[model samples]
Target: MSDAQFVQIVGAVYEHSPWVAERVVSQRPFASAEALRSAMRRAVQQAGEAQQIKLVRAHPELAGTAAARGEMTAASTSEQGGAGLNQLTPEELARLQSLNARYSEKFGFPFVMAVRGHDRQAIFAAMTQRLNNDRDTELRNSLEQIDRVVSFRLNDLISG
Candidate 1:
């Protein structure tokens, strides 16, 4: 893929961090979709603890202010919408915000998830369960979710 297209494809995959794509652009002519994904994963891994947290935090809370105001990226909007986060009732939105505030307070980052096959109940259950985890564990889980999100994006934009 051309440089611009490469960035266009993977940039939103990493939340607002186009630098992830920019950093990996020179390593292009990716052998396969998985190869491209691994390169993106390594970019996050190499970013170290602080940067990793920053990247995770770059994501807006599901059905929160960004979604309500329509300020989220198109990819994020669609992902959250797919999970039914976009259609929450006021009570549901309040519950999610309460959970989100608690989760962020505990982990210092927003709860991250792929949200493809998940519904609001599953998401709330996961959020409540994940809140019990220690910081490091939650961070690892966040990275795994980010990987899943990236993979989904790659599968959408790139073909093997």
Candidate 2:
């Protein structure tokens, strides 16, 4: 397939950061799913700290402003809804908002989680716990979480 078509198919695996896919387009025809996933991860890892942070910042916070205003990408909307983020109680929403603010304040980026099999309480607990982590650790953890999310997205887009 052409590079453009390849990107169109998987560019969104990393939320708004299509550059990850764009970077690896020249290395197409991956031998297996794991190969493709690894290339994508390498793209992010080699993108430098600034771009890595930008990639993490591209993700919408769980049930944050984007979700509230219905502005998140369709994949994000569905993934977050599956975690019951769309059905939060008022108190739950407020608490999450507070946590989001604090986390962003500390880390300079919104908190990110795969959120596929997790519920709101689990997400809350994770946010609270991750708040204690230093910036370097949180950045690494956030990228790892993005990898998990990208893995799920790639699975949904590909078949054996």
Top-TM-score candidate index: 2
> lDDT per prediction?
0.90, 0.93
Off by over 4 Å in 2: none
Question: Which candidate's lDDT is highest?
Answer: 2
lDDT of 2 by residue, 19-117 (tens): 998999999789988899999999999999999999999999889989889999998999999999999999999999999999999999999999999
Q: lDDT at 16 for candidate 1?
A: 89
Please give the distance, in angstroms, between residue 145's alpha carbon in candidate 2 and its true position after superposition. 0.2
Candidate 1 local lDDT, 1-160, one digit each (tens):
6898878767867888898998889997789888888998998899899989999999999888888788998888989999999889989999999999999999899999999989999999999999999999999999999999989987987653
Q: Count the backbone clashes (under 3 Å) in each candidate.
A: 0, 0
Model 1's number of clashes is 0
Q: Give, for candidate 1, the lowest lDDT window spanning 10 residues.
A: 151-160
Error of 2 at 30 (Å): 0.6
lDDT (C-alpha) at residue 17 in model 1: 88
